[model samples]
Target: MKTPLSPKSTSGLRGEYAGAGDDFTVEQDWQSYSPEAHDRWRRLYAAQSALAARYAAPQFLEGLAKLDSAGGIPRFDDANRVLQAETRWTLVAVPGFIPDAVFFDHLAHRRFPVTRWLREEHELDYLVEPDVFHDFFGHVPMLLDPRIADFLEMYGRAGEKAMAMGALDMLARIYWYTIEFGLVREEGGLKVFGAGIVSSAGETVYAIEDEAVLRLPFDPERVMRTAYSIDNFQQNYFVLDSLDQLIGSLVGLDFGPIYERWRHEQPLPAGQLQAGETPFKAVRLESLGERTP
Candidate 1:
């Protein structure tokens, strides 16, 4: 997902991924955004919020409301003010996609890099890169919860460790399947919690209501080792017993040895679901019962 940095700009930040001929860093002019962009943000915000109430996890709703999500294209400063006061998480603006090392560094320090741009109207429902709406709407609201915030910090620490171990691929799968496309079993039925799912109107319903997608139980080792695709609706979605169960399992586990063992192993494709082989089950998150470790 890395892109060559655009030509050097007067921005203070230096480019990390600029190609040999170019410097990547550029100053983001957040205020210069057009009225059309604001409309796009407002449209997206209103539409998604309506859908999310039905499909999104309850906590997501509460946090979204608490953040006053109705405002169009939130200003990082204003959003950060609220986020900082509530959970100490702040958003940093980045040009576009950043290197994994840089991304990990930001997360480790409780800074989430949000792109300052919004997608065009035609690009609605799908975009290859993370934008302001996706970053703030898709990801930020969850940060309001204490347990979820701690899990994110721990995840950042884990990312740093994984990078040192040369296991970024394995580590990314854990993020993709859990943070981006995860589901949780609720009394009503399966519900959406992953940002990736929340931001997509079609995928939101598909992930939660569709019988086609394979739903699997959450396992740290299995999740870390699994391979996922970003190009399509996930073929497999991992369901957690609860936020507490997910945090407890991963916040304490050592990924170094696990990554070492799984590095050379063949990765399972995004959609492979087998009852005995893949641990794909229909059990509710509450049904996980007691902790294993």
Candidate 2:
């Protein structure tokens, strides 16, 4: 029997970020944070960490404990010691979002570009752009899982090829639905592993408990044709049988022809499911129209 999901909250907005690096990385100024800044990190961590303990994937929980992020915002070197040892991955400080090619290159090399700042005291609940907490607290933990790590590198390699094929958008959708907002079925049932959903206190609850939205089984080809918003809660989500399924889906699958076909097909709207789709779990998104903008 599937376990019912518990309630959490949905999320809001994006913002601007500042990175000190010139090309793709910046020196993480470990000593520059103020007492107030640490306090902000503490508040954010205490709340999100509590939620993560309850809702995040088991692997993420394990990684979070290994990193010891509860003290405050983590120094890149401090976390790197454990990450490099575990999965050969490292986090680099960045001002904000980098170019697509640069971002992909980082992943290909097993390096993740983390935005270097924290959200202000007032903006703790939501921010327009990903801050340090969002990047590291939300994403880096999962990088410790070996299979997910390998798949990430493969994703980066595929992304570069997709860019050349003009299927970058198609590929971005894949990243959004999988890496950022994916759900995986476990012994207990559908659990989310995506950073975007895990990081936000609200999205943490909304993604799982709210049955008003579509939670279709993952189909990469179908995902490639879907649209999304950078500033809002996802209109749709895709579920995986397991993270292993995620890696399995891409193994020996070529996108060269998939991109050609996708390029000519009209994009699917963000909030609608395609006809003939069977929901692995029947859910009703009755509150979909009542969401915060």
* TM-score for each of the candidates: 0.85, 0.88
- Clashes found in each candidate (C-alpha, N, C closer than 3 A): 0, 14
Looking at candidate 1, the ten consecutive residues that score lowest on lDDT are: 15-24
State model 2's lDDT. 0.78
lDDT by residue for model 2 (33-65), tens: 888888888888899887776667788888888
The residue ranges of model 2 lying beyond 4 angstroms of the native Cα positions read 1-22, 282-293
Please, what are the lDDT tens digits per residue for candidate 1 over residues 1-293?
22224233324433223332222223346678788888888899998998887778887888898888576677777778888998899887776666676677677788777766688899897987777788789888888877778777777777767777788888888778777887876664667888899998888878865656678889888787677777778888888878777688876577778988988788877667655755444433334352222
Residue 221 deviation, candidate 1, in Å? 1.0
Candidate 1 lDDT for residue 267: 84
Model 1 has an lDDT value of 0.74
Error of 2 at 16 (Å): 11
- TM-score top scorer: 2
CA shift of 142, model 2, Å: 0.2
